[model samples]
Target: MPKSLIASAEWSLLLSRLRALAPEAFDSQGRVLNLVAREWGNPGHGKPYLSPVDGSQLGLLPMIDLSTATHAVASAAAEAEEWARVDLDTRKARVSACLDLLHENHELLALLLTWEIGKPVPQSRVSVERCISGVKWYVENIESMMEGREPLGLISNIASWNYPMSVLMHAALVQALAGNAVIAKSPTDGGLLSLTLAMAFARRCGLPMSLVSGSGGKLSEALVRDPHIACLSFVGGKVNGRDIAASLYDRKKRYMLEMEGVNAYGIWRFSDWNQLAKQLKKGFEYGKQRCTAYPRFVVERGLVPRFLEMYLPMLTSLKVGHPLLGETRAAEPPSVDFGPLINSGKVEELHAMMSEAEAKGAIPLYKGRLEPNLFLPNQDVSAYLGPCAFLHVPRNCRLYHNEPFGPVDSIVVVDTEEELVTEMNVSNGALVASLACDEPETARRIASELRAFKVGINTTRSRGDREESFGGIGQSWQGCFVGGAYLVQAVTEGPPGERLFGNFPDYTLLPEKR
Candidate 1:
């Protein structure tokens, strides 16, 4: 395929050019994956089909060559380390240059993102803009974070598939600009997006190939164990993340991981019913698949009956079919609210969990059928699933405790704010929580008591924003933030450069005399 190009000397001009290009769903030679849209939404014929608006999948996305990714990581790292040795201004300039390139090619990058996954065109555009914003944010703040630190000289970047281009781009580009060599891994599901990003950086930013690498199975283990691999950063599920953390601990590696969340929302004690209804609808519209998505509702006991009475009609109105066919309003089709689970395994897992919940005596007020969803044709396609809302017996049930990680949500009634806080805190994970309070005192109280990393007082908390410092606390994550200013500091720089004078032969003697 012919290489796509981005040429610019000014950041503004470059960004403008990028904004002007049409969406490039395929490569110049028409070799990249193709997408098919139906009346329901965009369908997939790719290796990893993720919706750009939401990270939900349309089909399996392709994986990049692990060797190729590794090579790129290694090369980028070397380039970054060399850049770091240069004067700070020069390093920043180089970093700025890469950012300029990224801005200049935003359209290509966004389209590459869309095709690699299944992001809507508009959302894909936002991802690119967000990445640019992230780079600038880091550029403005990274220097102070690196001062007075012992030269650790290593950065480990483990990225996920959800926002493949944006996540890895931040880690790789900023670290390189800050003068640290990066050893990186791309998620197994979103390989093409990562590879396209790798190519873009190499072609436009002049990144070396060695700085980025990927491995599957034991290869990931080996990469993690590589002694030169320094600061490790990971994004994935809780189980695999913990296992990876254990391995890092065994190797005594300095690392961070973004994992899972049993995220929750506290329906306001006295919320405006109409506005609350709208917000809750928007929450479920997010497909309830994000790590930070509102997965459970803790309605004040005084309000549960009324809230249920008021909310079910709205819930029943959701159209849970495909996301692309402009199904903006209304519920999904008769059977499914959204598309199928990313894979059959996920479907089975969700069913197993639901069955376990049922066996535990949690009566499902609303049951969603996986078999029907899978078998039902949506927008005339073979693979869409509708959304389902279920009400359970108790909030303390295992289903409520564990993350559904899908569009499914449940309700739990708490009598007091204290109980709500206690329940949210007691959970082993802590990604985010949404408190839907209207009064200032109530919002403040909930915000103060909430134990999650990201708190949403009046809105659904989101994990995908680049400007936000996103990552979970507790089991949800093992690190600090992932984007905005924090990501730059996390990789390229550390605390203020520390100065220590060691004993020197003749020089030490003269200094003592002075």
Candidate 2:
């Protein structure tokens, strides 16, 4: 049985805070306010968000057409130009104060995340807190980052909703601190209300940051093709990133794209079973929806038994349920490990992939129980999937090549060092990979062959900490990278139009590391 750490009294107070969340994707001077709902004798002109928690309707957020988006971007560009003229000191103060505002409102934002996307309360709070704190570190250090650089005009960031505050708002805040006005499209799936409040608070603090909510199909072309956007920072799937990359290819606009890939963990000569056991649960946190999740594992044949010994028990120990509910009541103590995926569609997709892998050659290692009892009897449980794992998933299976983007795990068995690296790199390239080998020479040799941006020799890595650079290799990333000083330079330039990254013959970027 799972426990809910939230007391009944606290849950009621949290609900009260969530009810106070009004949608507002604000621009400076409220320029885009009139565009939210045109009121052409119709109130049903937008999409209504369905709560992943209970399949209930949250509220209708109006969708705008391409023309409205164009107007919004142009208005933002004008604001950016004006905002750029403000003294650097004032910009820093306002932006830092904006971080302060978000910190104060994190509880409300966390609740909105739980209600909107079904993220567990603990992880949601951590995302909000980590993002605000990390971005604040950048604000205090931006002057040095901008020492020899000049601000680019308008920065348009289109990001996914998984880590709305940490990734989306994090980039936007740093862009503002760099003297660029930031504009964003609120992710279609979730974070609409949380990011709306973030943008509104930014506007109140005199930062030129704005966000729009609508269908990506309707707004993506305009958001990418618009003339006023000086740079684009995107966080989403590879297909959408490719589309935006195509639009920017001939135009010479700067961008930083963080896309998804099947990050893998390679296990070779290793005997630290207890320590390795401790890391398994953390790797599966948030149902492995994270872009950096190591969902694929390549294990040496000798270590297969040892690996399952740790992984199987870790799977059983994981608890999944409604974010706010316990086994008995809302007030019952202890929280779940995670909640549902973004939607039922994700659950279906994961199940389909798992089936495909099984049909090819994979053997089921573990399949935990789903606790749909935590949900309302009348509510849908399609979004809930328990921890699942497969052994010896063949190279021909779809799960062997692509990221399931859910809690499902695929492990490939290999006999030799060469086969281990081959299985690890079978996905061609990725953002992160991990290696667990007791021998330092084997670890060093294996690490050199893996095609990933960040390699954890004996652990896992993620887009945490302000000092670390975050970007991917191969299809996982496009355009220049973002993080630390590289992030600020994604928009600014040492000299106007000076190139910051080298490109392959086809123009895919080779991110510069200093």
TM-score of 2: 0.91
Best by the TM-score measure: 2
**Model 2 agreement with the true structure over 1-514: per-residue lDDT tens digits:** 2234344214345444533443333233222232222111112246767777767676666567787778778888888878778888998899888888888888778777777778887788888998899888987787888887878999887888788888888888888888998878878788876776777777778788766766787887767778888888888887887787777878868777777788989999999988887887887778888999888888988888888888888889998887766522644645678788888888888888889888987999888797656555566767788999998887788788888888888888889989888888876678888999999988988898887888888888887667777777777887776678888878887875556652222565544321
**Model 1 misplaced stretches (Cα beyond 4 Å):** 1-80, 140-152, 208-216, 250-252, 323-341, 367-383, 393-398, 463-468, 482-485, 492-514
Looking at candidate 1, what is the lDDT of residue 28?
Answer: 38
Off by over 4 Å in 2: 1-44, 326-330, 372-379, 496-514
RMSD of each: 10.9, 3.9
Worst 10 residues of 2 by lDDT: 35-44
Models 1 onward score TM values of: 0.72, 0.91
